[model samples]
Target: MSNLNKLDFTALEVSGRNYLKWVQDVKLHLTAKNLRPAIEEATDKPVGEAEKATAMIFIRRHIHDALQTEYLAEEDPRALWVALADRFDHQKDIFLPEARHDWQHLRFQDFKSVNEYNSEVCRIRSLLKFCNETLTEEDLLEKTYSTFSASNIVLQQQYRAQKFTKFSDLISVLLLAEKQNQLLMKNHQARPTGATDYDDGTRAMTGGSRNAFVELPACVIMVGIWVKDMTDGRKLDVMSLVSEDQHED
Candidate 1:
């Protein structure tokens, strides 16, 4: 046999357990014998050959794109936006042929667990579909709004403030929170780093023309006020409520 065809099946280091599990999962999703063929065919050649690499890349992209649909079901525009931001800012690294400074290079620490990362991959793709929608569908053309109860203000605030500049950062924060919680669980209850009560009042006005008033934390309030002061037209009309009773009056 030629040198190219002389590859040994015994030496090709495929994980038997993982390979079996992966095959089972594929069979569950797709009736085709994708895993069996993939494995059987691979036995005749080297794993990282050019054709195999290309195929692997294609499969990874398809899987990553499919996972991003989760945020759509939530119907939270901001959440969807965050999901896209997460993919662009975090998860694209593994699939991208080259790394760019502008594009986020996702790190291991950015995810709490592999499961969370996998979930986010799906979420980001779903959000991309939202982004690609027409202006009307995006709420720029036609909007919707919902009012929250007085008790929910605290929750609204916390949710808005915790949203990072990029969805990736937000995911990183969550992962960090989860990791810290785990540490706390292991040791006696000790607070984690960068863990703060991010209670700031702001809810998604949805499709409303009324700009969502996000009353940021004490640290961000001054920055918000400064930005508001500089704006000429109607600015983000955010007000601080010192106490719960203040809403009653």
Candidate 2:
């Protein structure tokens, strides 16, 4: 790392189970510190003794305590790099086949949610990449479309019609659609049967110099009642009133 005083990632494990990832992290940190050349097999320019010591110290700082003692006498970072590689490079063979299997079986429709499906996709893709296998964007999109539930064939076709160039863009649309569906379901459950709409009338003023009498036509007034649930055995209540108005001459 640029600042060697701080550790950017976990130190290499003594068992070497994390060797591949640790190797990658080491290379990145060494590169950031401009000490990569000291550990490289072939370098266009010469590496100074002081630079080698610096690279050695950086590598030692990122290794397990047991490893530090195991390679305590090692002076050159390049030699230590080769020694570590020889000891743990077989991990590639150990993990590649499983990564391939996981990649082959990953599917979008198999997951309950888009997030879960996406997580699996990413995990498989990362493992494949670490094994030196490339999982292209087209492959990702096709995998999702082909694995769609049988009932969603039409929906899958609609998404394919969008001709998405990036997997992220397509997944974003899928996630948004999922959230909207959930909201609609929640609203439906909140009110199983819909409610009625009400329209209100406006008030007006009409008069002769001295207020006279007026007889309005018989009118119908509508009052709506809210019905919570029909299956709950609650009684519905409604009322209607009729009255006559008298005016003086």
lDDT tens digits, residue span 1-249, model 2: 333457778888887888888999999988999899999986678999999999999899998888989999999999999999999888888889988888788877789999999999997887778788898999999999999999999999999999999999999999999999999899776643422121122111112211111222223233354334468876554211111111232
**Model 1 lowest lDDT segment of ten:** 139-148
lDDT of 1: 0.35
lDDT of 2: 0.78
lDDT of 1 by residue, 1-249 (tens): 122243221111121212222323433432242322322333554444443444333233322233424432533322332444444443333323222221133333355573555365444434333334222222211111112235556643564565334444444554676688788787544445333333233212222221233333333323245224465664453333222223553
Model 2, position 179: C-alpha lDDT score: 100
Pairs in clash, predicted candidate 1: 67-122, 68-122, 68-123, 68-125, 68-126, 143-207, 144-207, 157-200, 157-201
Which predicted model would earn the best TM-score? 2
The residue ranges of model 2 lying beyond 4 angstroms of the native Cα positions read 1-6, 186-249
